[model samples]
Target: MKLLQRYILGELIRVFGLLVVVLTIMLVFVGLFREATERGLGPVQILQIMPFVVPSMLPFTIPATLLLSVCVVYGRISADLEVIAAKAAGISAMRMLAPAFLFGTVLAVASFGLTNYAIPWAVANIERIVTQAVEDIFIDMLRTQHLVSEPSRGYSITVHDVQNRTLIDATFRFRTHDHHQITVRAEAARIHFDLERQQIELKLRNATYSNPGADSFGDWDGTVLHLPLPPQIHATKARHLTVADLTEKTKEAVLQDEIGQIQQANEAAMLMLTGDFHQFGGKEYSQLKGANAEAVRNQRRFKTEIHSRVAMAFSCLFFTLVGGPFSMLQARRQFITSFIMCFLPILLIYYPVMFLMVNLCKSGTLDPTWSMWVPNGILLIAGAMTLRKVMQH
Candidate 1:
């Protein structure tokens, strides 16, 4: 029994290792190309980012690779009449699958560890590295030309020219934090770089300002403006946070949003008592609505992300349960066909379902704790049916 288990596990591992390496390389290249085009990053920067990309991609790759490996290895075993020989030796079908099942569980546990820990770090690093590269190019452009345009970041600045700390024909188009568009056109501008603050100041003369939903202001004798040169980059996505961090953030948002609503309600009531009939439609109400929306989104996103990671981790074991048993019923001519039969459906169905569920969970249309596990539940049921049929046969 021990030798049989070793032989089976060895075959599975050998195939699994080869497949993992090939898949990881393919995924890394795809990621590299995608990042290069999106960020306009050079080879050196992409290479620097390659390692960070692998961890996040692994959770997506490992389950499929393991499934393929099991399909190939077990299909060959069943095709070669190994099951007949095993049964002749009084070994049950369940015993034959023991090694593969154990191997799958081990892979699942490892995947869980990586998804829970390494992925968050990798995601954060990838964002930081890419944004830093973008910031470098942005600063360079601002120094060389009197204009630096980044439509994505909502900034377009046109200055007549820059000469030893002075700018002419200067105009700045930018979006405020509240998402309002503002334009500032100045006759003459002086650039001051504050290294300590890591910000740039533009001292404008004879300036005019245009703000969203407001009239224009012009002919200012002097106006001082500060802009974040590189800007502060922060990862606001729940996926970039670990389980503990995400849970805490969700809790904090819930608490803060609730407290804000109570305060807003109290303020509105006081105003109403003072004969203000429009108190409910004031800034407090708007703020409360915004806070509530943000809180609900964060809570849903954080819950979905955490549950999805955990659910994805268990896919290795689930795939093993399905792939290992289903492969045994294939005919000799169906070796490659058998692998495809098992893999293609999963590739199409499982992923799309998982994707849909994740989106639903993130949108708060579904309960994340249950919704994210739907794919796993479906896979589990399918695997159990396959195993039961194999056992009966």
Candidate 2:
């Protein structure tokens, strides 16, 4: 029976590792293939960028592998009457799988760390690389003297002829957001693309800028002003930024229970009594007392994020205990059924808790801590019930 346990754990780990590799190749190729058409970078460039993209995906892939590995390996054992044989020999089915569940716990712990730390860093860099690639492509196009688009800010011109290190004929189109009409037509009497400063200088024989937001355009047909380009025009997109970067940038919006706040208040006010909002600290008191809605909401959101992380880590232990008695039923041994049963229950636990927590924060009914433990609590109760039944049998 001990050997059987070893055998099962080995087989499952092998399967899990193989799946991770296969999934990586498939996903990376798909990502590259899709992006290739629009970016038009050469193969060498794609290869260079693949390393940065792959690591971030592992956190998502690993959890899925853990779930399926337990299911398939345990399910098959039950199908073969192996559970009955083990039981007859005084080996409890649940007892036999103590090892596999432990592995799951380890994977979950690692995943939590990755989610918080490693993935965030990779995500931050992903954008920078992609941005550099796009800039390279645009620069390459400029060499052919094509009319390259400058990210809706204006048109771009490539210089092929120059006198005294000054550009000969450089003019980019400038337009309002509608883009239907060209707002500026300037042939640079002279131009210099400054690499050091990362900007293009257009010494326009004539230039014009249409101020669209003001519904006005100042008179100018022949002048070039050095305009500062958007630094991130060559920037990598959102995916490249790490979680910390995201947290730093958008934490303000996320906090404040902004999205569902109005809805929650409306629902609660219908039954909870409207004036209670004033007693807790009216909107006016919030200002004088420095107790604003945004701060409260932000605190709730942060707490929610913390609890959510803890609950996910706790899942590793929950899943392991589950695999134990499930093995006893011999029901857990079927590859197909076991995988489905194990994975589905987990998803059910995870998503609902997430959903409820978000709502609780919005509804003002749950603090972050209580909302997070809901999912773990449900899973623990379910596992306990199953374990009790299996041990009795």
Candidate 3:
């Protein structure tokens, strides 16, 4: 039985490792090919940028590899009756299945390390490598002169100084929402994208916006003025930012929004206390107090977002435990059926977990950290129960 357990575990780990390599290679090549043709990135440049892109994919990659490998390894074993023979020899069903579980446990730890450390570093470099390649290409364009790059949105770009991301002279003409012709020309302009704030500031020297009924076409400055933009201004621009950065940015925004509501409420309450509690029958103070209470209620609702992220990350451990027991059950599931069933329970658990998190956030009834992990807690219990059942056989 010991020998058999070791054999099975080795097989599981072997398959999982194989799948990870195969999938990573497949994904990397397919991504680069697709980006080259569909995204208009140069093949050589995408290849150069691939080291950065690959590590960023590991969080999803490891999970997927393990999931498929688990299904295949156990499914193949059961199909061949090796699991049956091992159990018939008086070995505990889950006892013989120990190898896969250990493999999964190792993977879970590795995933945490990759997600918290390696992936972050890789994502940071993704921006750096792409930025380098784009710079070189722009420099070549400038040297060639008459080399114009037009994006699908029909905006023309010509690089004046590649080193500074400076625009020598750029013109943009497009129809506005009000159905009016608009033309923008800027001389000696610099584009600044602020990743932390998810905002863009275009500082232009001698900028001009020309259209009907405008003095100097909205460029009413000596040599330079700044134009600001949020992500909405350029849909394509959002694609360049990494997912982690975006997630963190959203978290910060939600935090700020919640704090603003709290501060406003506190201020309103203090004002009411000054005018209403101390002063007799002040109508304005009464109204201000009412507004303050409404803000308190709204603050509850806005805080839900802050808790959602931790929930997503922590759910992995719970799900792994659940999968462990499920794989060792009576009348073990087929690979495809197991996968399909896995998602059904996941979705059902997800919505309720989300609902509870949101409610907890709104009511300030529970700590967000604990509330976010409620689904994980439930899965942990379910897993233990399943493990007991499998051992009973």
TM-score of each: 0.79, 0.61, 0.58
Q: After superposition, how far is residue 348 of candidate 2 from its true place, in Å?
A: 5.5
Candidate 2 C-alpha RMSD relative to the actual structure: 9.3
Residue lDDT tens for model 2, 1-393: 478788877877887788879887787787777556555656876777677557666666676666566666666776687877888999875676776777877888787776666655664554455556655554556555544566556655555544443444544445444654444444444544443355555666654456555566554545654544434434333333444544553466554445446545554465357546544454433442343365555555555555566566556667666654564455644466766666687787666766877678655687756767777677678777877886677
Question: What is the TM-score (0 to 1) of candidate 3?
Answer: 0.58
lDDT of each: 0.80, 0.60, 0.59
Better of 2 and 3 by TM-score: 2
Give the backbone clash total of model 1. 1
What digit string (tens of lDDT, one per residue) describes model 3 on residues 228-283?
33212223222233345545555665566566657656766776777645532465
lDDT over C-alpha atoms for residue 337 of model 1: 78
Error of 1 at 265 (Å): 2.3
> Which scores higher on lDDT, 1 or 3?
1
The per-residue C-alpha lDDT of model 1 at residue 25 equals 89
